[model samples]
Target: MTSFAELVRYLAERFLQAGIESAALDARLLAAYAAGFSPEETVTKRDAALPPEVLDRAVEAARRRFAGEPVSRIVGAREFWGMPFGLSADTLDPRPDTEVLVEATLAWCRKHDLAGAPLRILDLGTGTGCILAGLLSELPNASGVGVDRSEGALRTARQNFARIGLDSRAFFLCGDWGDALADATFDIITCNPPYIETGDIAGLCPEVRDFDPLLALDGGKDGLKAYRDIVPQASRLLRVSGLLIFETGHRQARLVRDMLTELDAGFQTEIFPDLAGIERAVAGVRQSGGDGGRGKKKVGNPIGSG
Candidate 1:
């Protein structure tokens, strides 16, 4: 009988030969999932015989992964902010870089001593509801609305909210940016909008270009379409002292900041780098010359941030 350890090594070799990154990690994850055991448990049973049913499922999963499907999508979930969030094809996969936005928001809250405050949050293009879910997980008393233009994505986000036990505190809305929110004012607004340039879509890795929904990836002409829509709406949706946090394309930080700067000088904007030293998050606070909100001009995060 093939041992579980042998099976994982076999799958890892297949994945590596197929040019998939993180081959070992993916192999172990798929193996553990197919065996109906936690990854930790799988590691413990590595020397044991692999059940035929387990190997069967693992083989199928390997085929899909080899075809360029993201392991997260294949597994039907992705962990964000240390929590397992369900996924749907219509929604963008939750990513680590986007966590910078959550970290920024949380730091701003803590810096301003709003940790225990009851706050209202608005998330635009909230694919999988990861942004809202991540923030709500940290800011206990806060509740939010995750707005997405796609009905399928909206439903997925709603399901994610419920799955993470934040259903009662979070709701999903179908609309473009603030259209569905009307005059609703929030203390904080978060978004990880589509920022990939239209011309650049076809050049993306197959996992993103083929599997990720176009509505969640294609930003018009120069990749600033969603920014144009979201930035202006933030001015209206946010309360006087509200904060707007965004996850921008690695190279689009300056442009995003410039766009916001041109829209309203009332906002104090800051660009923050991800762990890789790439500027990945931008934060803006509406200021009316009087500490409208967390007025510090430092990078998005400063207090136990990241």
Candidate 2:
């Protein structure tokens, strides 16, 4: 009979041999899930005998992991900003690096003395609603709208907001960029758009390329399509002095900044780095006089198009 400790070790070895990084951690996590225990609880129970059903479940999960499914995908949820968010085929798994955008937004809020203000936020490409939910959690009085093109993704985001007790303060919409949103309505806008170059997506690990929805991965041909579309709308959506923060691919921060600059929309831009010090987010403040001739710009499908 295999003990819990032995099964974990066996799984770890198999995972490592399969070229899976975080082999040990993944093994422990999958094993713990099979036993209906938290990963931390497994340490004390490691030496105990594994029930046949639990062992079988663990092995099956391990097979999925081996096939390149992410642990979060197998588990159907992921933690972002310390909150658990559910996932669906239409949504992108919320990742750790995305927290940089949250951090950047919060840092700016605090610096501007708006942390406690009743601010309005607009989250473009709100897959899973992680970014908007994270910000709303921190800003008690703030409310926000999450926009996504896929109805399925919006459904998952809505669930995520409800799960974290944030539904009352959040709304979800199906749309492209800001579209027909009222002008200067948001005090902050955050986006983590699909910026991966179409050609480079094939080079990403199986966990990403295979599992993450292509709608949330393909950024058109150049990888900056979403940014180009979103930045202009963000300038129109944000109020004077409002901030726009976006998560960018590695080395793409400079290019995004240049876009904000060329908008000539009275933006004051800055770049923020992730924990790895890669320029991961670009922030721009829509200064006074930055409405970018809002009155003359064309509108798209209405906000309730869904």
Please give each candidate's TM-score: 0.92, 0.91
Residue 294 of model 2: what lDDT? 40
Model 1 residue pairs with clashes: 241-292
User: Tens digits of per-residue lDDT for model 2 on 1-306?
Assistant: 888889889999999999787999899888888888776668787788877999889989998998889999988889999998999999999889899888878888877778899999999999999999989999999999998999999999988888889999988889887885765479989999999999999999888999999999999788999998887676568787788889999778999988876674756677777889899988887766545434333322111112
The 10-residue segment with the lowest total lDDT in model 2:
297-306
Q: Candidate 1 versus the native: TM-score? A: 0.92
Q: Write the per-residue lDDT of candidate 1 for residues 145-214, one digit (tens) a residue.
A: 8888999998888887777799999888888888988769999999888989999999999888988899
Ten-residue region with minimum lDDT total, candidate 1:
296-305
After superposition of all CA atoms, the RMSD between model 2 and the true structure is: 6.5
Segments in model 2 whose C-alpha atoms lie over 4 Å from true places: 290-306
Clash count, candidate 1: 1
Candidate 1 regions off by >4 Å? 289-306
